[model samples]
Target: MSFRSFLLIPLVVFLLKCAGSAEGRQSGIFLPTELHPDYPGCPAVDSSLYYYPVIGILTHPGDGASGRLSNATGVSYIAASYVKFAEAGGARVIPLIYNEPEETLLKKLELVNGVIFTGGWSKTGSYYETVQKIFKKALEKNDAGNHFPLYGITLGFELLAMIVSEDKNILEKFGSSTKASSLQFIDKANIEGSVFQSFPPDLLKKLTADCLVSQNHKYGLSPEKLQNNEKLAKFFEILTTSIDEEDQVYVSTARARDYPVTAFQWHPQKSAYEWASSSKIPHTEDAVRVTQLVANFLASEARKSTTRPDAQEVRDNLIYNYIPTYGGKAGKGYDQVYIFT
Candidate 1:
């Protein structure tokens, strides 16, 4: 070949390589290697695709019938509203079963930027054992320079507090009230200092004023319960509190002192996805705004994470392709319905 012919061959090869990489990405077959620093919290915005994050929801172990025909064993029984709540902020929520090995969970954590511990009456003692390890893993990831976030809802909040405090009695029955309650934020809860920093004053007012949050639990940590415990007080910064419909007070919400971890005692999803008339879940304009605001805040935090999913590893571990189980009052509120494996 002539010198010009040799030069033409290199140019052709370069073009082919570039085209192949682009096609692989579009097919979700290949992930590009992008340089990212290991940092905690939300990382600087550079990967636009990751801005719309795929959040992982840790499924509680429940072996009961969900409905007449529907039942679940592992991570199959996620609430429709929890999915809706996440999607409100333009994020997709996937189920992550914790029965797997520790290595498996670490890999799952690496795939997603943020994770949520959904609310339910789970085997607290055994469950917290797994959560403690995952919590430590997330802390390690953040310490090593990776931005990872964790959110606990209702039972999740209780579990988080128990793990952080190592106090099983830190949680107690709050008269087992399931009725809605108004939230009262501590003086420190606001958009400037804590998780509510991006939240609007009017929205905060609506959450407490309209009583949009759903309280369905027999046990919770009261503010007094937290203040008296040295471990809990030092580990968690109480963000909000509320009195149950039965007049029993509980710590409504909290955040970690130095991590992107937040916990909520109320179900923000109920007002939007739960349409069970018998349950009396709120579904008003302001109620939805509450879900959207919380969703957006979590999604924004997930976006701060620079962790990208592995093409082959993600397929082998997470990402279950299943048919949608549409139930509840209005049906599942979120899009991208997934099936259980």
Candidate 2:
């Protein structure tokens, strides 16, 4: 071949490969970064089907007398709603028992792509040293370029805030409304590129009209508290706020800085999975859609991990060695007392 013809052949091949990659991205197969600027640094989605993610729901100390019926000391449980939430988001769920040995917990963490610190009544108390360690380890993994996602709801949210702020006193007794209410989208520009980036316009719009968020805690982070605090202001960008019945404004949701960590002061799962007297949870069509949005988003993020827990690990941790129980209530498609010994 002539010299110019030989060189042209190599250039054509390289350009063709580049065109194929661009076509893949243009077809909605994307890296997390392309989907949203806040996404973790992870492998791009290929044309292959997405992985079915698994979630570890951390069980914790209970707060009330309702668990008096169970033989366990403190109810280490997850709402059936959360299980349904995971399933709806195209993932499977498992219980992460607290106090497990660090190695065992670490093994399980390696198996799942995400972990959820469910809400409970530990506002003024402490998390199991194991739970704390697991959380810290997950943070380290994400910081080290592993795309692991952690979600905290209600008390879970408070706990994360406490951890990131390194201030035990960051959470305070709300003293205002704890009833179910919708949220006000504050500083829309802030959430524009975060986890909610893909929100349907109608779904995002309903945040103002629908009573979708179920609030049940007396302890929460207010906007003032978030702004004035050094650690919190630096660690999270507040995405939404709500005016309680007593006109008190609180920080309802936040996304972490430089990580795929998200938290909510309101119970997004309650509207679909919880129902107790005085719970006052929302159950409207809008409420269900909002719940599903969160479920799908988190699950989708969970799918970003390039690995899955081993089958033996799944059997040992989620199925064979454990017994599931219900809380005596009906949630989406499961019992209230779900996934506890």
Candidate 3:
């Protein structure tokens, strides 16, 4: 054979080897159904001792430290506190980084019973778009029987509202204009005394008589604008009227308005500035109560999924003790007990 024929022979062998390697990789991708391990389902139980796993996602801070910081103390610290509170009542906590690709993040989400969206600096343009996309996808899966619970803090709370409403206007109304340090309140008048009122009667009662909400940040939701925004109007309607007051617990923050997702313009995790500011700790009791309430809410949701009736009473007790109490001068008795529902 000529030199050309020899070269052709080697090329054919090389192609054959490459084909075999690719086929092998393909086989590794799909495991056999029988090879997958299956544990016995959880037996029916009447105890509150059972535990559920919860995952917390950390967002990228727009300060160019997208990958450097996983826990922005203010966000992570509060989240960790909540996780500990949840564990005290029988729930496992898992912290996950949110910088992964969408598919990988979704896979990680599947492993946890619930999700917590931590607060951080907001991104710009396509970055925000991608972030919103992931949230929307997770919500869709959750609604479609995935059974995963979701909670957001600060910026995460804003994202949650945006996702549920699917209103891009959220960005235009709040995102584009407000600075991180600004605080805005919901304008109750826009709702025209409807259920969508910024402060529903129940929540208004809590704020006026029960809790002392602070105003620290520069930006917040304007109840009037939120109610007037044609798209958001419906969401506010559902959150106010449809969700049962007994099923939902509202927390008063250092901000305005009443809604499902409890949001605080001030960082409760900032123990120094928030608690120890002025040679005396401020709102320490309130902070502790907020953390406990969050933990209790998560535990209650988990119990519902596990069908553990024994935990119901414990859950009710928690709500009864923690809900804010009304009476006396507003914001005068800064007792932690007042915030406990």
Candidate 4:
């Protein structure tokens, strides 16, 4: 064979090898040799998990609705810490003003992936009715296979318990206000499918060993009451308990049996966000981590939501449209608050 023929033969073989490599890559049989810090295993992106999820936070009545932060009447407010918590978990927030018209509130629900019932003092009146309506809406969304989730904090927790039990008097008074407490896990406690599932083993242990979370509510559900109440028992399982100042054992955390609903009788956001000197909020590294991981769990659950609304419409209703008042400077319970009349 001629020398030129031999060179041509080598070039043809080289082209075939390159084409084979390309085909293998297209078929996902080939991966990059270089490892990136962000993509350590070069894992495929999960298109099913939404990266742009929006969470709706329901507003509470009064200025410092939970702690007497402000005396502003005819106004509703959402603590900035709650907003920060959602954002920390990679989710944007929209305020679901509790006192808004039923039509407006329902419309806003359609635009969100998840909802948060904030801590507040108002457990009765028009606010209570609004919460009931929204809670049912969330359940309906889940029933329709939308994968929507709800998080209830403090008063929010009490509301969920009351709504589920259909008994407004389900909550009993406990001297847990302004206290730093440690969680005591219950027997057969179900954490495997909860926000605590994302918690590191060490942190989970510390939750029981140390006072890593804060409690500042006047009312809570006892373990016995939760089990005996047919409705609450069927809806939520007690996850953790804490002793109040009066030596009363109350449920500190609980998770829904079937739905993506979790409730906290303590303030998980205070550790990392609030700087109120009056609070017994823990600021240790582990405490801050508890706040972060909880928020991360919320965002993760929201990512599973099937509702993907128009971006422009979401942007218009975001919490950013309202400015946060620096309530902390005035010695308010919250550092910042988004007040709406």
Candidate 5:
């Protein structure tokens, strides 16, 4: 063979090897069935009998008035974000559809370790009712000695509060308010109260004197409403009032108002501050800190799962090692990625 031909042959072989290595690293390259042929079935991880946690995320139905399907985009992004983070900490994440039948959902829930409610549009009466039933069932199961950890973000956060508090008032109070397009009422409240007017100490602490959160959602439990509703009061009493000093539940503008279930009004998945500092968008450092706190909180929750192994821990473990990517960026060793424009 000519010298040039021999050189080209070796170079082609090297290029092929590199391409194959790259393809192997990209998770999307594999089919779901190939990744886990027993999917929808309980499949053990690798050669070991051990299995990673699976997380079920509820998608937010988009604007019902607009006849839009639930905007799984944002929810999916956040879910993927948690999954990435959880995988990093040693776990797995599985996304579940909200429209699936309750029976199917429950079955899937059993196959996994936890559940997450993603944020989107306000849900209708039927959605709330269905959620209530699901919670009741879960509680019954827990009482029977089955434990599952749950997490909510934005809308999901509200759902978690409703579940623990069993207060239907959250629906009547903040539910409709989240449907508003702007912060007009919140702005008015700020002006009336000088932004530092003392709120309930517990509520104030959860909010942390951060006025920026007002920009995210206009509605929250008014002192008057909390004082008037016996059910709501009882719910809050259970979630926030009765906490032991040593309990580690982290309350934030994002997470729970109180309790093991948590929420985040802001999109931690967006990494808003990081994107903003890089001139990706206008952002505040506080936003970044909030997101990091969220990540840290999830990590903490995952660690707790080593002993508890509830649904939340199972979900957290799956997502602990997850890395964010975009497009087919999973090709770069990321389990998931955000598609932010």
Candidate 6:
């Protein structure tokens, strides 16, 4: 064949192949059935499931140490482990400064699909009021047909109990600080509609049989007290309990009955992320899996939210804008912390 004819023949074949591929796509032969918007008899795409979910993490007043990490006035901080946990579950984080003005704080709430009340000591004063306000907002969002989730960790759990009980003294002292404990599953029925439902059976068994969780709080609600408090009992279903150093039983895991709110008296984030020489935080594979599973659970819950916030506003408020300091070297329990002034 002539050289020019041969080149033209190759070009014609390439064009025919491209046309066939396009026809194949239009005929559903090349398109994934689940992803095609107009595929007949296929399940409709769930627009409600947002993949790029944003979580608001409430910051504590100070670093775990008093004026040790930062001495600036009106200072607040978020442990980097919590941020890492959210990311592990396929979510981004935004810091909800507890001390920010009411108007600003409420605005930030609108941007987040979920919120995490970090484990902290201040469950009173403005911080307490702020947490209560945010908790109510989350409930309101759920009540209004929007699926919003909230996670209360350690001290956050205590705050939730106190807020729901409407009693500041609801929490009793527990010698659980810096301790590793095995979760004692309460009842099989309790896990039926809860977050733990998504957990693997083997991991759930390990959670009950091994010390795969870390507890580091001075106060927690006893199972007996949680049972007697009408409001608390009505609001949350106790999932698991753990014994403290003194062998006192305290509520370790619980979830709201009607809302997408969950509370943990143990530090799930510390198991894989935080490294402190003096801490009892487990770093085993199962322990790290606990963190991963919990993170994924919360992120999945957040994805159910229908809030499609402005991308620019979310970008401005994301935790990525902040830098974390190596607090672990400073003798603090946290490996890294984002200190805000």
Question: What lDDT, from 0 to 1, does candidate 2 have?
Answer: 0.72
Worst 10 residues of 1 by lDDT: 332-341
lDDT per residue for candidate 3 within 135-217, as digits (tens), equals 66555655565544455555665555565556544632222211112112234444342222333355444433432222222
lDDT score of model 6?
0.89
TM-score of each: 0.76, 0.78, 0.48, 0.86, 0.48, 0.86
Q: Rank the candidates by TM-score, best first.
A: 6, 4, 2, 1, 3, 5
Alpha carbon lDDT of each predicted model: 0.70, 0.72, 0.40, 0.88, 0.42, 0.89
Which 10 residues in a row give candidate 3 its minimum summed lDDT? Answer: 332-341
Question: TM-score: which is higher, 2 or 3?
Answer: 2
Which residue pairs collide, candidate 2? 111-309, 174-218, 325-337, 326-337, 327-336, 327-337
Q: For every model in order, what is the number of clashing pairs? A: 8, 6, 24, 2, 32, 0
Q: Which structure is stronger by lDDT: 4 or 5?
A: 4
Per-residue lDDT value at 55 in model 2: 86
Ten contiguous residues minimizing lDDT sum, candidate 5: 177-186
Model 1 stretches astray by more than 4 angstroms: 1-49, 63-76, 188-193, 311-320, 329-341
Report the lDDT tens digits of candidate 5 across residue range 1-341: 99999889988997667657856446336656667877775555454222444444543343221222134443334335445444443445655445556776566555554556665545556556655665565445545644445565556656655655556456422322211111112222332212123333443343334322312233344334444656545443212211112321222232222233444443444443222112222235554444455444444343333223366545543334444444322222112333211
* Superior by TM-score: candidate 1 or candidate 4: 4
In candidate 3 the C-alpha lDDT for residue 18 amounts to 63
Q: lDDT winner among the candidates?
A: 6
Off by over 4 Å in 4: 1-43, 65-73, 277-279
Top-scoring candidate (TM-score): 6
Model 6: which ten-residue window has the lowest total lDDT?
A: 24-33
Backbone-clash count (model 1): 8
Predicted candidate 4 versus true structure: per-residue lDDT over 209-318, tens digit per residue: 99999888899899999999999999998889999998999999999988999999998888999996455789999999999999999999999999988899899999
